[model samples]
Target: METVRQRQQRRQSDAAAHRQRYTNNPQLHKFTLKFSEDTDVGNYFASHRIDVTNSTICNHCNALKLPTESPGMCCSNGKVVLMEPTIPPLLQHLFTSQDDIAKDFHDKIRFYNSAFTFASVGVRFDRELANAKNGIYTFRVQGSFYHRIGLLLPEAGSNPHYLQMYIYDTQHELHHRTNTIPNSNLNPAIVEDIKAILDEVNPYSINFRYISNFPEEDIKNLSMLIHTNIPGLDQRTHNVPTAPQVAAIWINNNVPPGAIQKRDILLRTRMNQLIHISEFSG
Candidate 1:
């Protein structure tokens, strides 16, 4: 005996109920974090001490002192001086840049905190030097890390880039190679050193093939892959309460039991799981 209008209403109600059921299901919430290009480097440097330099240097005998039997040849002065090695400023800059990216998006991306999963891909370009006939270029790339919950909420600061992340080539390699232009060959030693460092850090994950020569299309494709794979990059349906549900819950808690009391309890419980942000909230 129902009319066409009543049938339509019933169908809509069923669809909404199904959606709610799916949103509340815990099995559907698995996700990972990915970083973006704009994450802050300064904060990362401060936290990880990546920019802190440590090195070993040879001990030498001073002019006024004689050398001991330690290793090097003897000197007139008996006293030998110890020299601590120092990292060049250019190398320090590279570590700082990578750290910045990691810190910037740590909170927004949920999976970043789980273990230490991360991935990196970069590009290498060829350019002609000012005075040389050969090509000189550098390789660089940035990776992102973020969680699924971040997509639905605004970041703590108004900075949109605050939620982004990045890592790039070292300044020393870039500047030195670029200065020599065409004459400079791909320094196998330097390349091996970089590779060793990456392996040592063991960032969540890594992809080294996407060097500076990657085309624009390739860049776009890589970017798409990052977005799809990174956790929390896209907004998804969750157990958040609608405006009416929030109002109903508020009212029920403040007043005596009413017609909406049962629904309010369901909404409040769902919101608790989906919208918890206590860590970042003061």
Candidate 2:
């Protein structure tokens, strides 16, 4: 196992070698060495390269996952319902001053976690495909959401997100993502305050999961905020949702999607059969 100090030294050596390779190539340097922080942060990151504080659940701590072992041994797998609801910080200073810990965090591009990712939208239902059992439709969901984008609001968009900021390309594409979100129906004060807390160019949000059937067209980009309770919010490495609250999001489904407009009698949950209580079912 490599010690942290040894790892740092190796990283520095690797970076030096990389720069040495590009030093003679002026044109390539002009293209790649654009960001002032480029040398500080190289191209790729391994799973181990991620700092201890970044991952909410640890494969080792929670599940005892080993480098040699496969996943799915514990809650760290990220598939099960989160046992603990310790959601991480919404924001961190990417440009840290002269502190070792801060430098260590920022050195690895900590802001990248807060940065947005592309999320494809649009879901179609195809009965023809369903009939053949080849899968109902072509889920050709494209377009990154401007809102604190998907699977994990950090649920994780925007075209390329604010990734171009690192390279300083896509000048025209860089714009306020939340600006496109319709907020006429929401509390402008909350929105404004949250927006103020966020960087206009690179926004970050806590993860969100909800059970509502509200369509994207109906609610628009502000869906995550609506479902989550952002009050003097609980703070942790990863601010997790409260357990009962999260459970309610799914369990209390009075109605299930069956038909276009309740026309499908086969699928609709009748009032009596809506919920099956163990005591009442008997």
Candidate 3:
């Protein structure tokens, strides 16, 4: 009963609505990966170099794939595929500048001082306690005095990724005992607050310590985190991955045991509590 023009207009309106919903709805965006057999999904994504780890295909989209794996056989039947946003430009800039500073100064006193300022703070993963299955880990470090440090788990590619940085404070200190210099301005409250939040998520058990002199082991771990990405490449290198990419690498490399143990404990405790309440109510 509808005219051709009316049908076209209706389709356009439907598409506009779908786009709006996809962009605004977080739940809709969190769906996992899917794929179809009939289509050449790999070829289609070649230009974009889709990160297999992050990409996902919806059930509807997967249904459209043909049985063949050939390039021409795979075709999109107007099915929508959602893609996650790339790393933020600000993070990319920070990494780029940090890499440049490292190359220019190496390990000179001036370079080390500048590196601390640029990274805003120093952080290290306590490998002795990190575990992947339980998803808990400890971290310790020294940095600008009284600076506000924050740990962030920004949503990325259907998975939440974490980052920690110092938001405030910048100062220097000297260690009188060894006549050595250290970043004395680090804050204890920030570390405790981070641990408290981790306690709730139960992702990892975290312990934080502030020291006048950087712990040798902690410094080693922090160095690994900062230089986890490509050695000499800038933000635009073809093979050089993004900040999220490097963060993923760092997490994969360091899995703490204590953190995992705590995560299991928290998860079981919460689950049991919920079950008890449910039974009583019913």
Top candidate, metric lDDT: 2
Per-residue lDDT over 49-117 for candidate 1, one digit per residue giving the tens place of the 0 to 100 score: 333133222334432222333334443243555564565443444445556443333332232222122
Candidate with better TM-score, 1 vs 2: 2
Task: Name the weakest run of 10 consecutive residues (lDDT summed) in model 1.
Answer: 159-168
Please give, for residues 137-250, the per-residue lDDT of candidate 2 as tens digits: 333322332232122111114332332322222233223333323342223333333333443323232111121223456855332323335666655534644433321232
Model 3's alpha-carbon lDDT is 0.36
Quote model 1's TM-score: 0.14
lDDT (Cα atoms) of all candidates against the true structure: 0.36, 0.37, 0.36
Candidate 1, residue 33: Cα displacement in angstroms equals 45
Candidate 1 Cα misplacement greater than 4 A, ranges: 1-194, 197-205, 208-213, 221-282
**Residue 12 in model 2: lDDT:** 76
Q: What does candidate 3's lDDT look like per residue over 178-275, in tens digits?
A: 11224533233323333334334432222211231244566453322344367566745443233332322214247665653321111123222211
